[model samples]
Target: MRCQPPSTFQVYIWLKSKQSCLLCDETTDATFPICTGCETDLPWLGDQCERCALPMPMAGLTCGQCLRHPPAFSEVVVPWRYDFPIDSLVTRFKHQGKWPMGRLLAELLGQSLHYRFAEGLPRPDCLLPVPLARKRLRQRGYNQAAMLARWLGTHVNIPTDERLLLRVLETPAQQGLDAKARKQNLRKAFALADGARIKDRHFAVVDDVLTTGATAHALARLLMDAGACRVDVYCLARTPKPED
Candidate 1:
């Protein structure tokens, strides 16, 4: 006799048994690798800048910096603060080729986007992964932001166009740079890919993290110059500015 396929419950059990939480290494019933408890314990962004998503003391208002000199992007959405295990996970994913960790983070970010969309956050016409310079792509073997964008696109049903944005300059990494320096370093770093057409469309630039927002701003400016009507930013985590 021919064998039969397993029931849905049996398949669920099999998947649950095969998955373990990335943080605690405990087996989880959820489809994602992170357990519910560990997910809840991650450093979620609290009161933040309405425009830049920078962690702040107040919510539902734009920070002074944004009000003084607005970023090119109209809005920023990040689910986590740059802290603790989230930072460690981002490091492993970006520098160590730890793809599983990236997937976990992307899933969480997707969930945040889903809820935001339900709560009246505007969905973009397309998603653009912040492009990596060719040299950096070669060095890293893959672009972590592109990977996250693909995963998020699949989860959230948004179309992603990787070829629309190009990282034309191989500038030094943004780490250790102050906000002003970061902006200057990326001034002419991004460009539109040839034949790209985003006229009157809304798009979100996707990245693994938002630090000084320099890179995102550069890309957003490029997109706006390319005739995109609106540009938003989506990232896994946001780094708060240091106090003077």
Candidate 2:
């Protein structure tokens, strides 16, 4: 006699026994570290701008700022809003050099991009992790964006080109700066590596968080100037604009 397939309940029990929630340490039947409950509790972005992924009042509507001044990138793919536990987690991962936290976040973001691709989002030709300044890389010991990009690229089967974009300037930290100041700070900050070839290519810049989008804009402009036909931003989180 042929063996029968396992029931859904059996699979669920198996998963629950094998995995535990990252946030609460509860037994879970999910693949990722965070359980379904904690994932639902995440600051997931909803009804966001099609161009920039900024949270908006309604879905499929462009934000007023993008309408007024278009961004350099064609579109942004962000999985979460920068808030609460996510902010805390990103801080610990990015600043504290917590590799486990960074890996978990990148895995979740990769899953989000996979779903988006299933839902008709076009996969870019390549992924470019926004380069960190030499000074910052030396200080941090690793580039957080590069790590995220490698993880995401491996999961999604996209080529990650870390050498295409170069950070030529070591600017001050972007925290506490207004949009104008941020833009000014990023000006002349990025450059293309010598002998890089990107004509007619579509690329996505991967990062951990997008606040003010100054860095994305600067990098996208550099890529375009270097013959990239389309540039997109793929970030784990997008922060809302601060009120005046």
Candidate 3:
């Protein structure tokens, strides 16, 4: 028997099922925007500090800084390093308002978190996006962290509270600043919204990247002081130390 050619409608459906990889522009399935090759090329974090997620030479080690002064957050969960294409993807999503990129990253992070939860990591009562300054919020027209949290919430079946944390002070941007400077800039920068329920609840703070741990430290400390039982940091990428 001879095979019959597909109809025009079948061809249209096949074309619609394909999508473009955001990084390499190669054809991909409609499910994930990035192709498998591009996704594998992403800088996946490996052998990092267990607490802060800083990349290290070996696994199961804590960075000296964390040992000296433990961060208020219990643990940092990140899937990738802030290198190459991950950084570019975050920049486009955060600065250029490319939401698809953010959603893709969030979906991957959610999968990682789900696996961790199955491995006995405590699920937080709520997810809180690190609050953005009003000026920056107005300029950007959206909070990337908030968007990430919302997408992750939907993926993992958790609740997100955008208003739970508030950025009360509009300080200079943290970019180009040293760790100390970033910490100083965030001093008195965040506060809980009015009547926020705090005591005895576990929380996860969501952000696009964990750079110097300054912002995460500040927010985690605030939540800890407010009587949060446990606070975890969840971000898409963790930057390696500059000195490394």
Candidate 4:
């Protein structure tokens, strides 16, 4: 099933319930499948670099680095580039407490997952969002990644173990870190929340974006070490790597 687009249908329903569109505020009648307006605006990594899902000029599957050294996870699925309304939406959700948009993004994700992962895709045994640090979670009032996972699970019928991954250390943000620096900076940054809960399970790790993939890689590393049979990264967006 190709996932449906982000429906204006959800926005309409939500506005009808609240008597106004509050920008992801109302949880009542908040659950939805897909929306209308989001059909085309949700961009996809069409014929991208298989390793990172970065859009490539050529049609080859593997990028050089991925051929030389494979990543920790089985595959990477990215629906859109991290820019424009999405970048703004993410900023609002993460910084201004605009939570409903997270569901909106999830709608787009479900659709993209269908197109990207293929039909009859087996849902992971469980879904997880990369855990936020205790301080960050407290300060932000919510974890955007967890919210995304929740809505994604609701749409696709997968159980989301929201707490399966734990941030064991609080490291500097990866905003400016190079890929190599990112891996090093994230050493011991994460762990299985309770290894017992995740043992022998396949986990689909969800996040808002993939930028150097440092965090995703590190989290995937710990997930496998903690007994996850496989880890597939699902992100709303993937940023292009910087050119030298």
Candidate 5:
């Protein structure tokens, strides 16, 4: 038989355009690897809530809220909590649409996921980025979650199916909304895109951050309603519990 083709993974990491790896600007060629400093920062989720993946006192496996009523998605794998430098990174990337940081954040999420799923977390069948409102997409010119989803799909060898879902109802942004308001605003806010033949898929939902999870929870419920077997959330950061 004629020599077979290079697989998609091989084609994926193959440097196109001599690109600079995010976070550390290093030229790519045949020999040198991507920046290890960025690699280390990306590979592990330090001291987090086992259930929600919020960086918390490792003393407890689950937070009080999670203990009271667990969420729908399986264990969330988050590299950092929403604080310190991460809040700045997320704000710049999401609100300001700093596109490059999306790659850096995705690289970390992918690496952290590699450590988790490689050791065997049962990788999902497809990656669905948290959908953006059409209005927001128009204003920002891109969905940073979608950007992160692309990197993750390449790194982990899953298809990034952006068209699998849609944010049909444009709700008020979640930032200023209180917990009850957040839930109400996000309810009925999303739906599976028409003609999406997604039956029996296990999806990993990628996003920049997980705040109260009202948005993600709504999305997960939608996916489940549309026949997704399960959902796993992969996010760059998970917000710490709001102090009383």
Candidate 6:
């Protein structure tokens, strides 16, 4: 008699027992691919702006910009400051098609969110990924934000919706642009899909990184205008201010 193929559950169990660290490639007993040392060495976000997650000198203070001009999103929750290996991992996953890197990051992010929820953060009704422009989607072959949202949803048990929001305009890349220019570039750039029922719903917007937050602001404003009760931003990393 021939040996039978492994069941899906058996395959899952086998893979779990044979895991290797994605960073150092060492065999790791941890549930995720990262070894404890590598995880400890990541540039975790320290004190940050309560509203924007901007790296700050001290905790419990909102940045001046947020106090002066509040953003549409209520709060930002991020794990790392965009630097070194975290930035490298994100770039490889996003631009180089290293999907395992993305999966590792998403798993870590989901764990972080679970901690936050336990610490009194309300879970959102759903997750909405920032919509990618169709042109860029074709070039990259996938939307990294959408992929993150889906993986994170699976880990966290939150519903993920890739189609509720639409990118209406194909704006120039926001990279290297000042905050003002970025805001201008995103004006009229996003819209809610037809028949999308956003009224009185809380939502978390998922993305790989949060930089100037112009994109988050634009999307949050659109959702709020559609009557979303609250909006929060969740990302793997956050870029510090230019001078910081």
On TM-score, the leading prediction is 6
lDDT by residue for model 3 over 44-158, one digit each (tens)?
9989999999999999999999999889999999999999989999999999999999999999899899999999999999999999899999999999999999999999999
Flag the better candidate by lDDT, 2 or 6: 6
Tens digit of per-residue lDDT, candidate 1, span 1-244: 7377655435333423557888999988787888889988999999999999988887787888898989999999899999998999999999999999999899888988999999999999999999988988999999998999999999999999988888787899889999999999988888887888889999999999898888988888888887889999999999888762
Off by over 4 Å in 6: 1-16
Q: Tens digit of lDDT per residue, candidate 6, span 51-107?
A: 999999999999998998899999998999999899999999999999999999999
- Give the residue spans of candidate 1 off by over 4 A: 1-18
**What ranges in model 5 sit over 4 Å off?**
1-45
lDDT scores in order: 0.89, 0.88, 0.93, 0.74, 0.77, 0.94
Clashes of 6: 0
Q: TM-scores of the models, in the given order?
A: 0.91, 0.90, 0.91, 0.80, 0.81, 0.94
Candidate 6, 113: how far from true, in Å?
A: 0.6
What's model 3's TM-score?
0.91
Residue 209 C-alpha lDDT in model 3: 92
Instruction: Tell me the tens digit of each residue's lDDT in model 5 across 58-161.
Output: 63577767787777777787877676556776788887877667666777577768887768898999999998899989998988888999988998789899
What's every prediction's RMSD, in angstroms? Answer: 4.5, 7.6, 7.4, 8.4, 6.0, 2.8
Task: For residue 98, give model 1's deviation from the true position in Å.
Answer: 0.7
Please tell me which model should have the higher lDDT, number 4 or number 5: 5
Better-scoring candidate (lDDT), 1 or 4: 1
Residue pairs of candidate 4 with colliding backbone atoms: 3-111, 6-35, 7-35, 7-36, 8-35, 8-36, 24-100
- Model 1, global lDDT: 0.89
Indicate whether candidate 1 or candidate 2 has the larger TM-score: 1
